[model samples]
Target: MKLINKKNKKYIQVFQLFTEEEWTKSAKNYNKNISSFFSGKKYEIFIHTNEETVTYLIGLGKSTMQNFEIQQVAVKFSQIQKEKIQAVPTLVLADFLKEKQFEEFVKGLLLGTYSYPFDKKHSIWNPKFEIHFENLSQKKLDAIGTKSEALVNGQTACQEWLNKPANLKKPDILSSYLKNLAKKYDLKYTVFNRKKCEELGLGAYLSVNQGSAYDAAFTIIEYKTTVKNAKTFGLVGKCVLFDTGGISLKDHNNMHYMKSDMGGATAVIGTLIYAAEMQIPVNIIAILPITDNAISERAFLPSDVITAYNGKTIEVLNTDAEAG
Candidate 1:
């Protein structure tokens, strides 16, 4: 997990090939033409062996790169070369990229190693790898490394939460998890129980929970930095721990992935965690309305009318749309 910039160090070289012009410059020492092994097709990989070392040439089809695309390309490269790539020091020849591009490249590389195996027993591979950039300044590289680490850590947490099973990730459990996170991170946290939710007139949110055996959790987490005049940001997340289509019911096919219905909640929590971890100079408040949509006699009917927190009356057309 180290990021260093040392030219004399021996490391695997990753060359990003975009155009014939860049390819000619990169392949100069190899005495090869751009057409010899690659045509700059995006995500294309070419391995070149010299007497001393092996080089990996990857294609970037477009001149303009996006963060998500960079992450995908890195994931593909890592998966293909998983056996060959150990936790050794690696160099990315990114002299052509600007600071932002280089930052995203580093982020993509770190995120590419992410995998989810659920509760299944599996062998754990060492995720420790060092990356070295040849052309970027040490200060800039350090900054990029810090930012990338924060982003990846947050994203990893979000993915793990989303991948958890509905049975293990009930609304109360999720609320307690966030409360613990707030305590660990020294953030302000609050959770409203079912009665408190009723007092607050959260009928719309509570209605979605009536059918479930679990009580709904109305949770709020706040992160306030020391920065003066920091802008306050409020984030609201839909925390449907599980969605069973309520009384309407969903098709049995692929209904298991309903565990990910709380993705927005995880995203909000992840963002708050990232901001708190990085000590970002901003005030953030996250509101999560946690519930589960299931089938029962207590469940709201399709023709039922409910009142929302804002005193708006909503006629339930379908309980399947409860998460909406």
Candidate 2:
């Protein structure tokens, strides 16, 4: 297995020759053929047999691929590793014509690989997998390899940060991690304490965080530029790191996915880290508001209008959508 790069542009050129109908028909046929291969369930498992490993087709979703969902999938699959399922193969279905789909497919594949068990009862289950993509040209695969390497690193970092249960990764621990990362990257960071939040008129944000036993924080990270007064792109992410929906509360079923509500913030941080690492010549301001929206007497309720940093008032139409 060789890693292809842009040098194999010919494969991409061939993919471009097909019409939409041709591509879809080909994709369907490929799927059918693969499904048939696994039809008899003939693949068997032994103590050591790579041949026993079978191909599983995972859809990349009709909509855009969500990072957090991908992270969760990785987390789930990692458990299978604990069961001694090594060398699993995956195929991501996508249209080669859509660049975003192709990219997300590769990224998801990498994310899935991140879910390997470090320790098992007797032996650790490290990850080993062969990933195959349908309808992707060698050129596209090369381009994907180049871009995915960086994204995979970022995703891995985010996954590790999130994998720790809430007890181990409370506000203080998260703050410390950010601080160390900031210092290492030579970036400037300002963490807003509860008192600071009150003074800044961040009622909307504070209200959601009131029930958290842990101190909430608004982390403002700044990546500066060599040129003085360089324009900075401000990325404002809603970071209720864990949302239980406060006072209003959420169903147990819904709460399971709330772990990912802070996914947007996680992604913003991931992007900034990559940008700084690459020495991208641009200033960036990352705003992360991390909190938990749990049900409690202190939680904000419906119809409570709160103001944002920009002084925009939001009437709480749905108690669940409230943000500080």
Candidate 3:
């Protein structure tokens, strides 16, 4: 989306937002079909067109919505409108909405417009637009654009990673991806191979990786800011790219969905990316224990005792509960 300073009164599509109370008083001004169809019910949209303009009357239940509520409404509105309202569209924001609300609105639109990039044969249409809002400072506009872009990029990265097939993203493949992400932000990146894990006494993690065809790796990423005395946050994400349940096998019905076992790690990466994009003044130390739980003669058996990275002994009671 492009934001322009040039003001234009003519628009192909216009969004008219109204709360229940406001809609009640203004409903009579429109035709009976539109007024009867639209009573400002939350998430309901009524389209009214004349010889001159096409207007979409959107319903906002009340003025007292929380920030997430406003974002939820915007997301729904974006999906409903989809590619129908992007070119030269005018959004008549309700006066009751603050800058934060507007920011959430943009965020929702970007998120809703996003489609999986890998699938070219079938994809949702994302239309770009030139938009101008009234009474907004340059600083506020910049903030909205920056935050919205960061969030969409971050969230999209996680979704794509988590949705990738296990075959495409084995342990080594996942670490390589993380390394590139770290380098993009100039963050410190380190990966401990299977030998290093054994030396570091990360037995519990290694035990789970012993049966995999690919080697095990532990990835650590650090995001540091230049701010003096900045507080640091530590995050640990389990990156079991695929969980086959090893000896204690998972039910076959939903076993394929195990590709999402790395969701935790992808989520952490997403947060790190978002923070880095926003240039947040803080330090983030993230650790990802990456491997798959596969079945083979080398796999750890039940009741085996293993030493964890912290040097604590872990007695494996249930093999499926390796990372649980």
Candidate 4:
């Protein structure tokens, strides 16, 4: 195993591209030979080669070809990182046995490379090579490495977006940042003016914005996918990005963790970016309903019957739950 050291940025850069080719090659070479495992209806481990070290072929099994869910892969990869193997090539095959029953595997394989320098910090470690695939295709393999690289960049941005304190991550600033991403990625987006939201029957979402000093804005984002004639899916996320309970206030200190309230929206936007980058064949109608709640003379109160854009009326039970 090659140990990571002060000047060794190559190891970090090695897993930059998140793609199929990279996953296959790294898995094939993890050590001269490896075993594989696929877990689905049954937990059966099979040996693909007579190679030395144990390589597992894990199949996601049924429903593997459904839309990609990053969280699932993230959890598994995090588990692998915990094992601390100096370097191992891993390949996860999803629904390779059937067509349409396929979904590509995604993971943050390089997450283990991340570490902060502290007085109690541990020594540097070697890089672990890994890749995931739904099926085999030379063209797709060629693109996988680059896709992985882009995911790393996106994840870095997401981490910063998630870490910002609420006050700093206000609606206006959050929308601005998303706009920047849309422009850079060729995504089509439109921000609905507050008045437009009122006209659109987006009352449930708008009610949450009533107490904020800043006006609320609703965003509609569209990312075209590569799957020819694929049906579009709608992703709606609550973009409280930051939440401060309105007049129905809570302990002042309790609001500290509100920045993460918008995680759903962050994930929605993140998916749009990745889908666009990978040219996945699917259409998405993503809605980011943005706002904040702060107590003011103009703040809405409990018992208010606010109607949502979908014509559903929410009887405000507690203003503190405004982001929901």
Pairs of residues clashing in candidate 2: 78-115, 204-324, 205-324, 246-293, 246-294, 247-295
* lDDT scores of the candidates, listed in order: 0.76, 0.58, 0.79, 0.57
Q: Could you give candidate 2's per-residue lDDT for residues 1-324 as a string of tens digits?
A: 123322221221111112233334544544455433322111111121134333232322223434444434333433444344334333333343365545653454355555423122311122333344556577777767667656766666676656655555567777888899889889999999888999998877777777777676989999887877667799987776677766556787767667667677778778777777666678999998877777666667778888876788988755664432
RMSD of each: 3.1, 8.9, 2.6, 9.9
- Model 4: lowest-lDDT 10 consecutive positions: 116-125
Task: Please give the TM-score that candidate 1 achieves against the real structure.
Answer: 0.88
Regions of model 4 farther than 4 Å from truth? 1-109, 113-143, 322-324
TM per candidate: 0.88, 0.58, 0.91, 0.59
**Residue 74's lDDT in candidate 2:** 38
| Worst ten in a row by lDDT for model 1 | 118-127
Global CA lDDT computed for model 2? 0.58
Task: Give per-residue CA lDDT, model 4, range 153-205, as digits (tens).
Answer: 55545566677766677888988988988898888989987799888787876
Show model 3 residue runs off by greater than 4 Å: 4-7, 118-128, 321-324
Name the top TM-score candidate: 3
